[model samples]
Target: MNQNIFENISDLITSGAFLEAEQAAVDLLEEIESKDDGSQAFVIFKFNVAGFLVDIGHALSNRGYALKAVEIFESLEPRIEGVIDPHQYFYNRANAKCHIVEQVSTFDLTFSSIETLVEAKNEYWKSIKEARKVNEEFPEQYVNLANCLKRQFRLSEALWYYDSIREMAPEIPQSWINRSEALLMLNTVSNSYSGKMLHEISSGYNQASRSKFLPPDYAAYYGEQAERFRQGISENDHAETKKEFEELSEYRKYCCRSSLTLSEHGLYCSCAGAARDNLTIPLAATTVGGAFVPQMEAVLNRLKSEFSMARRCYFEYTEAEIEIDLIHEECFTDLETNECLGLDFEKLRTAFRLCFGVLDKIGFAICEHHSLKPKSGMVYFQNFWQLDRDNRREKFEEIKTPGLLALYSIATDLNEHKNGEWKNFKRLRNAMEHGFLVIVHPGSVDDIFGAYELSGDVELVELDVFEKMVEQMIQLTRSAIFSFVFHFRQKGLEESVPTGPTVSFQRVNLQM
Candidate 1:
């Protein structure tokens, strides 16, 4: 293998040309097969070919091409095994099997013990030794070996791999970032890797992992998404959530009766791919410029129905402007999770859109005045409460706070009470903002868990965060409005100045 051709193959594989990558692998293999199979060039090409195949397989998996990835991994297994040791191919082969198992409805994965996984994992690194014996300039190979070892509970070995790579990776300085990430994982060795820690990984390691795993498809734009389903309590969101939940629940009864039992074992979904349709959401809100008073009022009414807080709350959505104190300003925060609700909306919007689609195909928009791009009669506010993946509504029943919704109830101080009227919106927003968008699907014990998260984001969060936020925001709003009214009345400005909802709607032209 000429050094130039070897480098080209590396570039192509890293660029995600998998078929081309396979052909490149075969080219290297054929050259070695016909002449000098044990030459220096043969050794270099075999190592390059095997490494490329594995990288391509990883790329395929990241792109959601699971079967394709499995095929790539499987195809490379036999060829690479012959050139390298059996240990080298173990990790990719195991990962391929794991992905396949993950997709199956029933595969009896318990039969595949962790010990077997570890053995395979260990072999994968052992092959790296053979590859390095041929040519040792490859820094990423060491990092890859470390990551594979780390996945199988081999923290020390993984760290050794990363540390070695750190020493060897001067050509690729990003390895320090990788080193930073691998170090962080050590902290995560004993603890759960979710919530704040998950954010750290996505922001640091996951982001770095993307560059390593799929250089061509590294996600460039990401931030936290707000889960303001409590805004569902707002008139617009409330009306939307209520109407949507009832309609979906009613439809659920019919769908439940329509279950189709599989010929093999379990019952097939009665939904004629309603789940598929739900994933492809469509937005229907009309965007016009300025005077989006009606939209705000509409949302406010629904929020009023859903939320009651202790402090004056402000709900902020970005348009051309940042702060528009028309309906209300939400000083939204998950006191429990300590998540801020005032992050950028664009990143969070995608998450809401995803969660909305998960909720029976509803789409959402946070229109500023009439600045919604196109005009339409209906604006489909996204419903995070939609149940599909695993009967999330049933989970909601299990996690609901029965007494908090009452006219007069004091449940904020209670640690066990399940109410996230405040925190859910903020935390969900935070999670979505950061690229972990699928949490809004309501397959968990709490739908509001999508908001601020509860127990654990991977589990659940404190109900107090939600309850207190709601309680405080409501009290604040009432007080703020009362002060506004008294001052206006005292100044005699009430007669001449505009009175009523601070934000009102009017027909306005959309700039975009």
Candidate 2:
């Protein structure tokens, strides 16, 4: 029973049923204790069960239940001494710890302790050391170690490990991702030196008297010898100034050229292109204000595609109506027979409703992408408009810019008036989505009709008017998205100050 129990548990875990395997392990342990009380068989069975449980722990960790997996692994720590391989046990434990740290960093709002990060870093280091004893060439150990170093702000050390992985396994996409991420961090740190000149002047040291300090003109007189000591502190062409500006420009290019790709799951880079089979759109790796550029691109692309499809459907419906009109006016024997000729008003209605639905979707997408606050899952586009209004009003008060204030005024008017354009649009969308009966009254002119919801008193105008309304809404949404993207881009650039000085200084003792 004990021998077969392990096999059964392994099968469950292999099939991605972690919960069932955990329950089975518990049931098997209880059965063994009840039947084989204090017997040698019970001890051997428990040890074997403990080893199987370790595998389950690792599986749970991989499946994103890192905290639970850590708990399971910790419980088996006492029994793991002789039951499992030291390298395997330590490696799994280390990976689980790293996952927990990552989860906490990303999602846990309550955890802000530095000690937790340090603990995770130590565990990763310990795991790497243990794994190396058995297999020095293990790639996972190096990768995990690199991530650990990066999390601890050890950028240079992290780069070393990432470079090592790239050299060893050049085909791995993660190696390139990690290398690029480290380079970005290093660039940010090196370029963040805004008040360097101010600081140098404030230090109260005379530039000419300072050792090895050559003013701007000193380079022309001393020729090559002066070129080496010339400082960039002056306005003119000093050798040191040329070197500084060139280095800064190079760093800026590196930062700007960093690109990310959007897939179904999340943001990736060109390095992951080979691994992904889904649609991928490449975008600059900059943040649009607080919003990410890749995410913004994905939302905008989806909105544009939906809008285009709706426009095509509208054109098709209009074309069908025009053909029916021509047939009745010129080809048909009697005008009355046009009605009996079997025009599919239902299909046209369906197409019109679809256009409305797409317009509503665009509004919701715009709100979701730009809103600073989390949206309510219950209400769709209503919440977005409300939040956007609030944000615009707040910004207007702070900056009092005329253009922003005008936008704020529009939002205010929309919110204040019950029969506002945005409100009418929202109510119409709600009716259509909730299965309210939509009636279309045919107009005297061909290809024109009045559409309205059964529950609402509002009467929509002719087909052309409706089309114009939809077109206006589509244009408004498009403009809003572009404006938000531009606003965020400017904000992000403004806030992105360098973290440290590009130049380094050394202290020397001077005796005069």
Candidate 3:
């Protein structure tokens, strides 16, 4: 490897000529690859080359070319396995994705932006796992992960991450600022926990404001936020908040009552309410308005119905009573040699299948609403985000609804991530769709495997694991439904009203 070439690339990066640096780095990487002499010295040079590529990626990210930075990192992924520290590589990738997320406009959902954020979250998780293997603690990774969770609107999980960081590294000013920001966001949505945490939140901001590590502008911002929060303490309306909760509908109350409540699941009842309340009126006939209104309403209605069914089946599977005869006889196998039999719960299976089906249906709805034409006239939830990988930014990306973006994130999770919960669900769904799926006893398998690992033609899943998959799928489906309705509702609100004369249609009430 030529040392001068590496030096030139570094100098270019230092001079903020990132485009030149990127090109030089790519050319050098190609030259190194082409001249692999299979020598020990050459092998060591490759690792050095890997580190240099990482630097190039960082420089591109700094230059606000985060997507380009991501592309560069992705190019390195094939050879990165043993060349670099996997944790460090993933952390760097996560940071690049976070940069993309930050640059994304608050409106106009782009595939790269929201999907990148989800990818960043997954990469951070991989980094966390790698760190855990070596018994290493990195507060910055936790803070970044918390920030990702906050951006995803998972306030409860974000708060937990922030609290964990504070306990381990209280001196970190960013964690305090991030926690305070999450609290402020929570206050706007729900008073359930915000009112109780207001004083502590204000104090956190105050502490952040005093930190010398933060820039002067940042410190002043925190100080103003702290004072503003402190003022809210004097005008707190606990009575009104309590009354609001009291007035919550049965559905909202049920959502709040779950073990994984509204906040924990990232599914807000307020979002669903906003869509349902405002979208009830029938619209006047126009070129597309009339068709859009009915279609949107129908999709919303089906989403609610599907979610209700999935939730009911899930609950019945977990909590409903069953006859002793309904249990398989093999379930009573002796403890020492126990590899019991699968319990045949139709409700659980129904819930799992329904959850999978509903997601695909939502994809179809999105395609219809956006007038998006999928390749081969086929659209699955997994492939709904992009039909052509080459054309990364499709027309669908123009819809910048937050909930819809979240929906796409869920699709990314199910389709891409190898996390057991999501991967298992996808595997099971695939088996049901194109292969045979069989349930085995919970203890039958020493470890879980994908649907492709089949005995003859059937894929076997542990009964308990299948049950858990059903439970999670139900929750995911619920979140997807909320995202579909709420985000589109938000998009509707953001658009300017029509100024020209329009026909008015009477509000039609459907009899149940």
Best by lDDT: 3
Full-model lDDT for every candidate: 0.35, 0.42, 0.61
- List model 2 lDDT by residue over 1-512, tens digit each: 64776888877765557789988977876676577554445555655565455556555554344555466556666665656555555556655665655333211221133234434544554565565556654676677667655554444345556655756765444444455444444334222221222222222123222323333333233343223323443443234433443444332222212211112110111122212223212212222233344454465566545544544444454444456565556543333211222234333444445544443454454445444333444323323334235455353234322222212222321332422334455555445456442333335433223222234544333444444445434433332333333333333344455333322213221100
- After superposition on all C-alphas, the RMSD of every candidate to the true structure, in Å, is 24.6, 27.4, 9.1
Worst 10 residues of 3 by lDDT: 264-273
Which structure among the candidates has the greatest TM-score?
A: 3
lDDT for model 3: 0.61
* Clashing residue pairs in candidate 2 (N, C-alpha, C atoms within 3 angstroms): 192-498, 289-488
Listed per model in order, the count of residue pairs whose N, CA or C atoms clash below 3 Å is: 69, 2, 2
> What's the CA error at residue 254 for candidate 3, in Å?
7.5
On a 0 to 100 scale, what is the lDDT of residue 9 in model 1?
Answer: 77
Residue 273, candidate 2: how far off, in angstroms? Answer: 28
Q: Which stretches of candidate 2 lie over 4 Å from their true place?
A: 1-291, 318-371, 374-392, 395-422, 436-464, 495-512
State the local distance difference test value for candidate 2: 0.42
Across 1-512, the per-residue lDDT of candidate 3 in tens digits comes to 66787778767765557678877766776777787775645544554555455556554544344555566567666766666577777787787777765533334435555656777888887887687677775998899888876676545556667766888888788899888877665544322343335665787899888886665666788899888777656444445444555676655554444422323212222222221222221221212233354556677677667766766666665665665766645345343322333443666777788888888888888777776647667877866566355463556566755566667666766775324216556777777667867666656444333433445555677777677667557656665665565555554444456333332445322110
Residues 132-172, model 1: lDDT tens digits: 55653356556554554334323333444554564556444
Give the distance in Å from residue 445's predicted Cα in candidate 2 to where it truly belongs.
Answer: 14
Model 2 root mean square deviation, Cα atoms:
27.4
TM-score of every prediction relative to native: 0.29, 0.29, 0.59
Q: Where in model 1 is the C-alpha error above 4 Å? A: 36-38, 61-116, 124-142, 153-199, 205-214, 221-512
**What's the TM for model 1?**
0.29
